[model samples]
Target: MKDTVLNILVDLTGSDEVKKDLDVNLFETGLLDSMGTVQLLLELESECGVDAPVSEFERSEWDTPNKIIAKVEAMTNEL
Candidate 1:
Protein backbone atom coordinates (compact mmCIF):
# COMPACT_ATOMS: atom_id res chain seq x y z
CA MET A 1 0.00 0.00 0.00
CA LYS A 2 2.82 2.36 0.81
CA ASP A 3 4.46 1.57 -2.51
CA THR A 4 1.21 2.22 -4.36
CA VAL A 5 0.68 5.57 -2.66
CA LEU A 6 4.27 6.54 -3.21
CA ASN A 7 4.01 5.66 -6.87
CA ILE A 8 0.87 7.73 -7.25
CA LEU A 9 2.49 10.72 -5.57
CA VAL A 10 5.59 10.36 -7.69
CA ASP A 11 3.53 10.18 -10.85
CA LEU A 12 1.43 13.11 -9.79
CA THR A 13 4.45 15.15 -8.86
CA GLY A 14 6.31 14.10 -12.01
CA SER A 15 9.39 13.51 -9.92
CA ASP A 16 11.51 10.45 -9.34
CA GLU A 17 13.64 12.01 -6.64
CA VAL A 18 11.13 11.55 -3.88
CA LYS A 19 12.56 9.05 -1.44
CA LYS A 20 10.39 6.48 0.25
CA ASP A 21 11.77 7.31 3.67
CA LEU A 22 11.86 11.05 3.16
CA ASP A 23 9.35 13.12 5.07
CA VAL A 24 7.73 15.22 2.40
CA ASN A 25 5.28 18.01 2.69
CA LEU A 26 3.12 17.79 -0.37
CA PHE A 27 2.75 21.55 -0.58
CA GLU A 28 6.23 22.42 0.57
CA THR A 29 7.80 19.94 -1.82
CA GLY A 30 5.51 21.16 -4.58
CA LEU A 31 4.55 17.59 -5.09
CA LEU A 32 0.89 18.46 -5.01
CA ASP A 33 -1.14 21.49 -5.82
CA SER A 34 -4.82 22.08 -5.13
CA MET A 35 -6.00 20.17 -8.15
CA GLY A 36 -3.39 17.51 -7.67
CA THR A 37 -4.97 16.64 -4.37
CA VAL A 38 -8.19 15.71 -6.10
CA GLN A 39 -6.32 13.67 -8.64
CA LEU A 40 -4.51 11.94 -5.81
CA LEU A 41 -7.74 11.14 -4.05
CA LEU A 42 -9.09 9.58 -7.20
CA GLU A 43 -5.94 7.57 -7.63
CA LEU A 44 -6.09 6.42 -4.04
CA GLU A 45 -9.67 5.35 -4.49
CA SER A 46 -8.87 3.41 -7.61
CA GLU A 47 -5.66 1.85 -6.40
CA CYS A 48 -6.49 1.27 -2.77
CA GLY A 49 -10.13 0.40 -3.24
CA VAL A 50 -10.98 3.07 -0.73
CA ASP A 51 -12.93 6.23 -1.27
CA ALA A 52 -11.17 9.17 0.32
CA PRO A 53 -13.76 11.61 1.54
CA VAL A 54 -13.20 15.32 1.14
CA SER A 55 -13.28 15.58 4.90
CA GLU A 56 -10.43 13.14 5.09
CA PHE A 57 -8.31 15.25 2.79
CA GLU A 58 -6.15 17.23 5.18
CA ARG A 59 -2.65 18.61 5.18
CA SER A 60 -1.58 16.24 7.93
CA GLU A 61 -2.91 13.33 5.95
CA TRP A 62 -0.62 14.09 3.05
CA ASP A 63 2.29 15.21 5.15
CA THR A 64 4.43 12.15 4.60
CA PRO A 65 4.63 8.58 3.39
CA ASN A 66 3.89 7.17 6.83
CA LYS A 67 0.83 9.35 7.19
CA ILE A 68 -0.43 8.30 3.79
CA ILE A 69 -0.07 4.64 4.71
CA ALA A 70 -1.86 5.29 7.97
CA LYS A 71 -4.69 7.10 6.23
CA VAL A 72 -5.08 4.34 3.68
CA GLU A 73 -5.02 1.76 6.43
CA ALA A 74 -7.71 3.65 8.30
CA MET A 75 -9.82 4.02 5.17
CA THR A 76 -9.40 0.34 4.39
CA ASN A 77 -10.39 -0.58 7.89
CA GLU A 78 -13.50 1.55 7.60
CA LEU A 79 -14.44 -0.55 4.61
Candidate 2:
Protein backbone atom coordinates (compact mmCIF):
# COMPACT_ATOMS: atom_id res chain seq x y z
CA MET A 1 0.00 0.00 0.00
CA LYS A 2 2.84 2.36 0.80
CA ASP A 3 4.53 1.53 -2.46
CA THR A 4 1.36 2.16 -4.42
CA VAL A 5 0.77 5.53 -2.80
CA LEU A 6 4.45 6.46 -3.26
CA ASN A 7 4.26 5.55 -6.92
CA ILE A 8 1.17 7.66 -7.43
CA LEU A 9 2.80 10.64 -5.68
CA VAL A 10 5.99 10.24 -7.70
CA ASP A 11 4.04 10.11 -10.93
CA LEU A 12 2.07 13.19 -9.99
CA THR A 13 5.07 15.15 -8.77
CA GLY A 14 7.45 13.79 -11.42
CA SER A 15 10.05 13.51 -8.69
CA ASP A 16 11.92 10.30 -8.11
CA GLU A 17 13.55 11.66 -4.95
CA VAL A 18 10.19 11.86 -3.21
CA LYS A 19 10.53 8.26 -2.08
CA LYS A 20 13.26 9.23 0.35
CA ASP A 21 10.93 11.51 2.23
CA LEU A 22 7.92 9.46 3.17
CA ASP A 23 6.53 11.99 5.59
CA VAL A 24 7.15 15.07 3.51
CA ASN A 25 4.33 17.56 3.14
CA LEU A 26 3.47 17.28 -0.52
CA PHE A 27 1.33 20.39 -0.57
CA GLU A 28 3.88 22.61 1.15
CA THR A 29 6.62 21.40 -1.15
CA GLY A 30 4.46 22.16 -4.20
CA LEU A 31 4.71 18.55 -5.17
CA LEU A 32 0.94 18.15 -5.20
CA ASP A 33 -1.69 20.67 -6.05
CA SER A 34 -5.47 20.57 -6.30
CA MET A 35 -5.47 19.20 -9.83
CA GLY A 36 -2.86 16.59 -9.04
CA THR A 37 -4.77 15.56 -5.93
CA VAL A 38 -7.80 14.73 -7.99
CA GLN A 39 -5.75 12.72 -10.43
CA LEU A 40 -4.13 10.92 -7.53
CA LEU A 41 -7.46 10.05 -5.96
CA LEU A 42 -8.56 8.53 -9.24
CA GLU A 43 -5.40 6.47 -9.46
CA LEU A 44 -5.77 5.32 -5.87
CA GLU A 45 -9.26 4.13 -6.58
CA SER A 46 -8.35 2.32 -9.80
CA GLU A 47 -5.06 0.83 -8.72
CA CYS A 48 -5.36 0.37 -4.98
CA GLY A 49 -9.09 -0.31 -4.72
CA VAL A 50 -9.44 2.36 -2.06
CA ASP A 51 -12.37 4.39 -3.25
CA ALA A 52 -12.14 7.38 -0.94
CA PRO A 53 -14.47 10.18 -1.82
CA VAL A 54 -13.09 13.61 -2.61
CA SER A 55 -15.16 15.08 0.20
CA GLU A 56 -13.23 13.05 2.74
CA PHE A 57 -9.82 13.95 1.45
CA GLU A 58 -8.26 16.38 3.91
CA ARG A 59 -4.77 17.75 3.59
CA SER A 60 -3.98 17.07 7.20
CA GLU A 61 -5.07 13.50 6.91
CA TRP A 62 -3.78 12.61 3.50
CA ASP A 63 -0.87 14.89 2.94
CA THR A 64 2.04 12.47 2.98
CA PRO A 65 2.56 9.04 1.53
CA ASN A 66 2.42 7.40 4.96
CA LYS A 67 -0.73 9.28 5.87
CA ILE A 68 -2.37 8.44 2.57
CA ILE A 69 -1.59 4.79 3.04
CA ALA A 70 -3.02 4.90 6.55
CA LYS A 71 -6.16 6.60 5.28
CA VAL A 72 -6.68 4.04 2.55
CA GLU A 73 -6.00 1.18 4.90
CA ALA A 74 -8.55 2.51 7.34
CA MET A 75 -11.11 2.97 4.59
CA THR A 76 -10.56 -0.52 3.24
CA ASN A 77 -10.71 -2.07 6.69
CA GLU A 78 -14.10 -0.48 7.22
CA LEU A 79 -15.53 -2.35 4.25
Candidate 3:
Protein backbone atom coordinates (compact mmCIF):
# COMPACT_ATOMS: atom_id res chain seq x y z
CA MET A 1 0.00 0.00 0.00
CA LYS A 2 2.82 2.34 0.87
CA ASP A 3 4.56 1.51 -2.37
CA THR A 4 1.38 2.14 -4.29
CA VAL A 5 0.84 5.54 -2.71
CA LEU A 6 4.48 6.40 -3.22
CA ASN A 7 4.19 5.54 -6.88
CA ILE A 8 1.11 7.73 -7.21
CA LEU A 9 2.79 10.64 -5.51
CA VAL A 10 5.85 10.28 -7.66
CA ASP A 11 3.76 10.15 -10.79
CA LEU A 12 1.73 13.17 -9.76
CA THR A 13 4.69 15.29 -8.76
CA GLY A 14 7.21 13.99 -11.27
CA SER A 15 9.58 13.48 -8.41
CA ASP A 16 11.41 10.49 -7.02
CA GLU A 17 12.20 12.38 -3.85
CA VAL A 18 9.75 10.44 -1.75
CA LYS A 19 11.54 7.97 0.51
CA LYS A 20 10.06 5.27 2.70
CA ASP A 21 11.93 6.58 5.70
CA LEU A 22 11.29 10.25 5.12
CA ASP A 23 8.38 12.11 6.64
CA VAL A 24 6.75 13.77 3.68
CA ASN A 25 4.11 16.43 3.87
CA LEU A 26 2.72 16.57 0.36
CA PHE A 27 1.73 20.23 0.61
CA GLU A 28 5.03 21.27 2.17
CA THR A 29 6.91 19.25 -0.38
CA GLY A 30 4.95 20.93 -3.14
CA LEU A 31 3.94 17.48 -4.34
CA LEU A 32 0.34 18.50 -3.98
CA ASP A 33 -1.65 21.66 -4.17
CA SER A 34 -5.39 22.21 -3.80
CA MET A 35 -6.17 20.84 -7.25
CA GLY A 36 -3.74 17.97 -6.89
CA THR A 37 -5.30 17.11 -3.59
CA VAL A 38 -8.70 16.70 -5.20
CA GLN A 39 -7.25 14.55 -7.94
CA LEU A 40 -5.41 12.40 -5.41
CA LEU A 41 -8.53 11.81 -3.35
CA LEU A 42 -10.43 10.82 -6.45
CA GLU A 43 -7.73 8.39 -7.48
CA LEU A 44 -7.57 6.89 -4.03
CA GLU A 45 -11.31 6.46 -3.89
CA SER A 46 -11.34 4.75 -7.27
CA GLU A 47 -8.41 2.49 -6.54
CA CYS A 48 -9.45 1.56 -3.03
CA GLY A 49 -13.14 1.33 -3.73
CA VAL A 50 -13.92 3.74 -0.97
CA ASP A 51 -15.67 7.06 -0.92
CA ALA A 52 -13.94 9.91 0.81
CA PRO A 53 -15.84 13.06 1.43
CA VAL A 54 -14.24 16.36 0.64
CA SER A 55 -14.91 17.40 4.20
CA GLU A 56 -12.76 14.52 5.36
CA PHE A 57 -9.86 15.83 3.38
CA GLU A 58 -7.27 16.85 5.91
CA ARG A 59 -3.62 17.68 5.84
CA SER A 60 -2.80 15.08 8.45
CA GLU A 61 -4.37 12.38 6.33
CA TRP A 62 -2.02 13.19 3.48
CA ASP A 63 1.10 13.90 5.48
CA THR A 64 3.02 10.75 4.61
CA PRO A 65 2.88 7.40 2.88
CA ASN A 66 2.07 5.58 6.09
CA LYS A 67 -0.75 7.96 6.86
CA ILE A 68 -2.16 7.51 3.37
CA ILE A 69 -2.19 3.75 3.85
CA ALA A 70 -3.89 4.20 7.18
CA LYS A 71 -6.53 6.49 5.73
CA VAL A 72 -7.31 4.05 2.91
CA GLU A 73 -7.36 1.14 5.30
CA ALA A 74 -9.79 2.94 7.57
CA MET A 75 -12.04 3.93 4.69
CA THR A 76 -12.06 0.37 3.39
CA ASN A 77 -12.88 -0.93 6.83
CA GLU A 78 -15.79 1.45 7.08
CA LEU A 79 -17.23 0.03 3.88
Candidate 4:
Protein backbone atom coordinates (compact mmCIF):
# COMPACT_ATOMS: atom_id res chain seq x y z
CA MET A 1 0.00 0.00 0.00
CA LYS A 2 2.80 2.37 0.89
CA ASP A 3 4.57 1.55 -2.31
CA THR A 4 1.46 2.28 -4.31
CA VAL A 5 1.10 5.67 -2.64
CA LEU A 6 4.77 6.43 -3.09
CA ASN A 7 4.62 5.64 -6.78
CA ILE A 8 1.74 8.03 -7.25
CA LEU A 9 3.64 10.80 -5.49
CA VAL A 10 6.71 10.16 -7.57
CA ASP A 11 4.65 10.21 -10.73
CA LEU A 12 2.74 13.36 -9.87
CA THR A 13 5.68 15.38 -8.55
CA GLY A 14 8.50 13.84 -10.54
CA SER A 15 10.48 13.80 -7.33
CA ASP A 16 12.51 10.80 -6.35
CA GLU A 17 13.41 12.62 -3.17
CA VAL A 18 9.82 12.10 -2.08
CA LYS A 19 10.70 8.46 -1.61
CA LYS A 20 13.90 9.21 0.31
CA ASP A 21 12.61 12.06 2.43
CA LEU A 22 9.30 11.07 3.87
CA ASP A 23 9.06 14.21 5.97
CA VAL A 24 9.90 16.75 3.30
CA ASN A 25 7.29 19.44 2.71
CA LEU A 26 6.19 18.78 -0.87
CA PHE A 27 4.16 21.96 -1.23
CA GLU A 28 6.91 24.12 0.15
CA THR A 29 9.37 22.67 -2.31
CA GLY A 30 6.96 23.11 -5.19
CA LEU A 31 7.01 19.38 -5.77
CA LEU A 32 3.26 19.43 -5.31
CA ASP A 33 0.68 22.11 -5.74
CA SER A 34 -3.11 22.26 -5.74
CA MET A 35 -3.36 20.79 -9.21
CA GLY A 36 -0.95 18.01 -8.42
CA THR A 37 -2.75 17.30 -5.19
CA VAL A 38 -6.01 16.90 -7.03
CA GLN A 39 -4.40 14.49 -9.44
CA LEU A 40 -2.95 12.63 -6.49
CA LEU A 41 -6.35 12.25 -4.89
CA LEU A 42 -7.67 10.93 -8.17
CA GLU A 43 -4.83 8.45 -8.37
CA LEU A 44 -5.42 7.37 -4.80
CA GLU A 45 -9.07 6.88 -5.51
CA SER A 46 -8.41 4.75 -8.55
CA GLU A 47 -5.32 2.91 -7.38
CA CYS A 48 -6.09 2.41 -3.71
CA GLY A 49 -9.85 2.77 -3.65
CA VAL A 50 -9.54 5.66 -1.24
CA ASP A 51 -11.62 8.56 -2.35
CA ALA A 52 -11.02 11.83 -0.54
CA PRO A 53 -12.89 14.88 -1.66
CA VAL A 54 -10.82 17.95 -2.53
CA SER A 55 -12.85 20.18 -0.23
CA GLU A 56 -11.73 18.17 2.78
CA PHE A 57 -8.11 18.17 1.78
CA GLU A 58 -5.72 20.20 3.87
CA ARG A 59 -2.21 20.84 2.64
CA SER A 60 -0.80 20.08 6.05
CA GLU A 61 -2.42 16.68 6.06
CA TRP A 62 -1.11 15.73 2.65
CA ASP A 63 2.18 17.61 2.55
CA THR A 64 4.60 14.75 2.72
CA PRO A 65 4.96 11.17 1.64
CA ASN A 66 4.39 9.78 5.11
CA LYS A 67 1.51 12.12 5.82
CA ILE A 68 -0.16 11.30 2.51
CA ILE A 69 0.18 7.59 3.20
CA ALA A 70 -1.28 8.05 6.67
CA LYS A 71 -4.15 10.12 5.33
CA VAL A 72 -4.87 7.53 2.65
CA GLU A 73 -4.74 4.72 5.21
CA ALA A 74 -7.18 6.62 7.35
CA MET A 75 -9.50 7.13 4.39
CA THR A 76 -9.18 3.53 3.26
CA ASN A 77 -10.29 2.36 6.67
CA GLU A 78 -13.45 4.40 6.22
CA LEU A 79 -14.41 2.43 3.10
Residue-level lDDT tens digits of model 3 in 10-78: 777777776544467778877778888787788877766778878998887667766777888877788
**For candidate 2, lDDT tens digit of each residue in 10-69?**
899999756998888889988899999999989989988888788988888888878888
Number of clashes found in candidate 2: 0
Q: List the candidates' TM-scores in order.
A: 0.84, 0.91, 0.80, 0.95
Candidate 3 least-lDDT 10 residues: 17-26
Q: Candidate 2: list runs displaced more than 4 Å.
A: none
TM-score-better candidate, 1 vs 3: 1
Structure candidate 1, residue pairs in collision: none
Give the C-alpha miss distance for residue 30 in model 4, angstroms: 0.5
Which is the leading candidate under TM-score? Answer: 4
Per-residue lDDT of 71 in model 1: 86
lDDT of 4 by residue, 1-79 (tens): 8999999999998879999999999999999988998899889889999868988798877788999888888888887
Model 1: CA > 4 A from native: none
What is the alpha-carbon lDDT of model 1 when measured against the actual structure? 0.80
For model 2, state the Cα shift of residue 31 in Å: 0.1
lDDT of 1 by residue, 1-79 (tens): 7789888888988886555545777688777788888988899989999898778788866777667778888889888
TM-score quality measure for candidate 2: 0.91
